[model samples]
Target: MNSEPANRRIVRAPRGTTLTARSWQTEAPLRMLMNNLDPEVAERPEDLVVYGGRGRAARNWEAFDRIVATLTDMSDAETLLVQSGKPVGVLATHPDAPRVLIANSNLVGKWATQEVFDALERQGLMMFGQMTAGSWTYIGSQGIIGGTFETFVEAGRQHYGGDLSGRWLLTGGLGGMGGAQPLAGVMAGCSVLAVEMRPAAIARRIESGYLDREAADLDEALRLIDEAKASGTAISVGLLGNAAEVYEEILARGDLPDLVTDQTAAHDPLQGYVPAGWTIDEWESRRERDPAGVIAAAKVSMARQVRAMLAFKARGVPVFDYGNNIRQMARDAGVEEAFDFPGFIAAYVRPQFCRGRTQFRWIALSGEAEDIRVSSEALKGVVSDPTFTRWIEMASERIRFQGLPSRSYWMGLADRVAAGLALNRMVAEGVVSAPIVVTRDHISSGSVASPNRESEGMLDGSDPVADWPMLNAMSACSSGATWVSLHHGGGTGIGFSQHAGFACVADGSDAAAAKIARVLGNDSSVAVFRHADAGYPEAVETARAEGLRRPYAEALRG
Candidate 1:
């Protein structure tokens, strides 16, 4: 069986550097695992759901207990294997080997559909990983808020001459990853109107300080947004309604927002998105009893949403896909011009990828806010990138700690290595309180293959190739990452994506420092190498600038 979701409990991660396991390598993962299920961090911890359409941290309560027990008792020279979210075995490996290796939600290509996956889930044979969820790298909404904020700012720079004042962004979804949109939009100097289907999701975002206010209906939402737009003031308003319905309403009213995108779990129709007019209860009921019907209905709704989005695009508003595979679903559901607008990565974030820049994050093992504060300052000393410095300062002052005190910002390879080494040294020198575990979102430049997202619109037209993520995980293991994971159907839905996640523990020792250097450096090199092979001139130049020996990079660019 895949899981026993009925076994609900309160879970919290330990908040100190004291070893709960034999070493920091194992202990870090233990804390992160529990942190994924922390009441504040996860979306639905009682049901084992972390975020992104039922992505779970464990197969069940039983599996969680076993995994904790194994971590506590494991030797430094052994590695634990996890299948999906279930612990499968402990194998004899060297100390330099990853403390844990994981593979989640993978299926044969022909069988990678909602029907087959739902069957497997019902039979208890699989779990959805959804980027960082099952891989234990989730740091809550704070994890994505920085990237989201940056994306909005970039969009403004591209479309509005580096200013979003007096403009408003319209988007959907307010759970987990998507919840960051409201605050991020406000931070980017735009008013945001976020539509969320679930009532509780809206309330949660508000309580957690990610949202400014909730509107009783569409009129109030628009009024609030209009007030902000008139004054050129940054504000956010959450609307309690299905995005498809609300978007259609906005179109009917001819209220043209400056920019538009979406973040609904449209990648997983049956679980992630609700049909346009269906109540949550009816949607859930049909999802359980008639999965096929639910899929068909959701696709129809997705087509309608895409049609509305296309309408906005046709009217000259800057509209883009937010990488949830909604366009694919709409195209399959018979929307012919579904690809008219570009995805976010292609529209705004691909340049960063070209430089091997990623949303790199580090979590304090001590769970002390001071540890994160000190690390943030240390990171500034190491990277010196203006964006990094500004983001670190803003994050240090504005972000609220979720499960663990952590900080994230965009960094390229060399800066990542430098920061990793510096953080390791800090742990060793007691400049900070304890060790830090470094990780990144699996939706990265070189580690993900998703035609609608990370790898969309490649110069070489090789967006569907899945080999890069495998190589990424393999290299992470070989380069001494503390834990490495390979996942399927992350970001996009089943049969749509493959990616990897890795974590390196800097525990203040020489050995840990060496490992951190190798992993961070090698991982980014492979990342930029993928972009260079894709024929992006920026990637080729970055690769050459980094002194990577790629003899054919110039030829590929030419």
Candidate 2:
């Protein structure tokens, strides 16, 4: 019996790079552990290289080193490339073949494991692993090719200039996808400008001591760029935000000098911003729907636009987009969905909430049942009577007929009802006990008011009011109970909310609660119900009155 852990398959490492025997197996075993991955062997075993020790830590480091060495070697290629993680390999292709570069962090292989690598490699292009030493590793017919940090810095220096006097602009600094691209340019001898809406985000940059204290927001960033341009500096501008809106706005401004944006779409919005040329760093290409639908949709749209814009690149216009290649590869492979939302959510959410005493159950409800149950005379006695029929009709119309800009705003409601009913059925069938039903209730007075005013008050709160019982119901509900709830106004009610029956913690209670509270105050209206105060039924009555009866009945049925 070989008696070795399956993780021990020889993976290719860069030539001239040191490696341990055990590192060779990491890719193989890691692939096996993942559900969708298949282990890919090197085309030629002799071309395969290994690094690191058999022991876990050494194996991990060696794997990283291999990626770094490969990327460093590839950066020497002719094409201007931007990569995620580390730029490991630059393709040296025939004149007819488009130049390709793989830029990613070495951590991609180590953490994403072999499954991701196999999936990426199956695209039939050269694969490179980004190295931690600020380099890249190219995996190919000849084996691992390497590059180094000095090379990347030199490339960046050559591209941006040595004095760091180039004009640079950045946006979306307030959100996760937003950050200091201009700062990178500044480090590369470009004058840095950043635009961010979130005060806290701006504060964070200031606190980090990264950006020039004077540059904040789009206008300020542009002013800095203009100032740098007057000083005879090379200019690079970056736009950041949600792809659609930010790009649209940047194009509308019409003032950008040498504009560059992280827009996934290739066609630069000609209305406001025109670029001398753009470069794209294809960050996320294949994303699964379900959990990651929103992000995937955005990326897909960006990729499509980028493909369309590639032609402009040949017109002597520099446009950066990564869609043409990825889309073609994806289409060839017939992969309908590439990104995994469930996997992402599970990876991100499960550890934080699942393991603790805090527990959550997915409850789905039938829209019809919810309407009938909440409107029943039995429940209406204590709870305010709502116009259930009207609300349902409106929701249905919005989903089916209205061309609302935000489909999620409408379809999500129906999804919530359906999911709640499904959950109710689960409870009724004993698949789960004490499941909580979540739904959306309307509290806004303008055109979308529920008939039950007081119930809405208790649930939605016209202004800022704290209902201890409602908070208790939510905490109790989160533990082990089927509670009826909805998405929108629940931000004001229970600490639980839903997007098409997919449950999420209330917005106020999201990971940044403390920071938000610090801004909103300890006694802010947005405070979510705490677990310590779990004992309220008044809110339950309000819920019951508002078509939450099916979930309540299902919960009580047991």
Candidate 3:
């Protein structure tokens, strides 16, 4: 082994005396071996070390033995090493030292058992493991998985501080699109100031019990906002109406902290409605031919609406545009008729009922057919007579100028009447082997006589006659070898409107019957059935037997 200089010889200290150079030198080799064997040993440059002279080998041997004995008597030592770099090697050495080392390890393998982790916890040691490469990877992987630094930075900012709760306001509570805005705002936890013009309409809304008790007009709404501001609540406002005066009034009040308007298409009446002749295919073709022109046209239209909305925005209000499917909206609004003929035909020929294919055939009387027709023609003669007027007038004062009825009431009534007439005509024409004529109690003029006795039936009883126009039209089709599938109408006891009827011809020969069956065969919101001839009770029974279904049962009950 190595030898030390005589001048550097270590002197032994007395028993229980503080450690001296000679004592440390004599005990150096044994202490070094013990430190090496001890897993808790520090690095060579940092930890204490000793050297011995050649003459002191015997003393060194004795000192080494004494040192080992002293160490055995002492308790295990604990040390805490805190460093910026990895202290894994230091930690591995002191496996049992109740020690802690803080560092980042990208791949933290299962190094410590449950017992060791518990021991570390007991010793109040916190080991923090953070990602080293600034990239996340599964074990045994090296490549990045679409890391975004900007997103990470933004996420960090949000986590530290981000305000989410802000006051919101919604305007307009009268027109279709505008009316729904306030309701939507209330659901989203925003304060709403519904500004409706018509007092009667507002009163109607109040009567309907849709609004809150505190809901009020513009003046009252402004008063509430003033009161809220006095109470120190931030108020944000949203406008939904097209009225420029109301928009200007809101701007002039100047109490709103934040204002937003849903004036998506305020400038033009045809803003969101597609022009009559444009189809999706044609639009796409035009888009390809002159993309810039198409864009400019769209921008011009949109810019006008935006400029109108910007009147409020210029007064420091924010605006929101709730856009919709323009083409679909136009079609629903009946503006599609203004389009080209092909487009108009496409819209008309589109399936009305989802499940069926029924072509509404328009028939006009010729010269001889018209000459033979009479205004007071009998119901049977009308069905058989081709001279009957093809165009039937179904008038409704309630129809809007927009060329659309308020609801489906008239259309549904017409369809039901047509079905009955077709069936009766088929039976008269011998197109069907069997024609079942079903009539409900409310529509039939016959007495409440049972079908069991034909002579007991009185043709001119209390019930109103069937809708003749629809019958006449169907009958014309039936006379041309088209079998009617079913016919139904009401009996004496009930009113005409309450009564329903249908006729069923044998299946094979009638194309109209096939179409009706195809249309009616699927699951639908509405169902038609053969009417009962006997009475109301019989009609109910017939309806039940036919398995007739209606989606809006509650609405129909009235």
Query: What is the C-alpha local distance difference test score of each model?
Result: 0.89, 0.26, 0.27
lDDT of 1 by residue, 1-558 (tens): 123345547888888767888878899999999999999999989888999989999887778889999999898899999998899999999999999999999998988886788779889989888889999999999988877887899999999999999999999999898899998898889999999989999999988888999999999999998888787698899998988889999999999999999999899888889998899999999987898889899999999999999999999999989889999999999999999999999999999898988878999888888898877887777895777887777666667889888888888888888988999999999988888999988878889999989899998999899999999999999999999999999888889999998999988999999999999888888889999888799998998899986767555657
lDDT of 2 at 343: 18
Per-model C-alpha RMSD: 2.3, 25.7, 41.0
The true-versus-predicted C-alpha distance at residue 392 of model 2, in Å, is 66
Query: How many collisions per candidate?
Result: 2, 76, 27
Query: Model 1: what TM-score?
Result: 0.97
- Top candidate by lDDT: 1
Model 1 CA lDDT for position 494 = 87
Models ranked on TM-score = 1, 2, 3
- Cα deviation of 457, candidate 3, in Å: 69
Preferred candidate (TM-score higher): 1 or 2: 1
List ranges where model 3 is wrong by over 4 Å. Answer: 1-166, 207-210, 213-217, 226-242, 263-308, 324-558
> C-alpha displacement of 252 in model 1, angstroms?
1.2
| Number of colliding residue pairs in model 3 | 27
Steric clash pairs (candidate 1): 1-124, 2-124
**TM-score top scorer:** 1
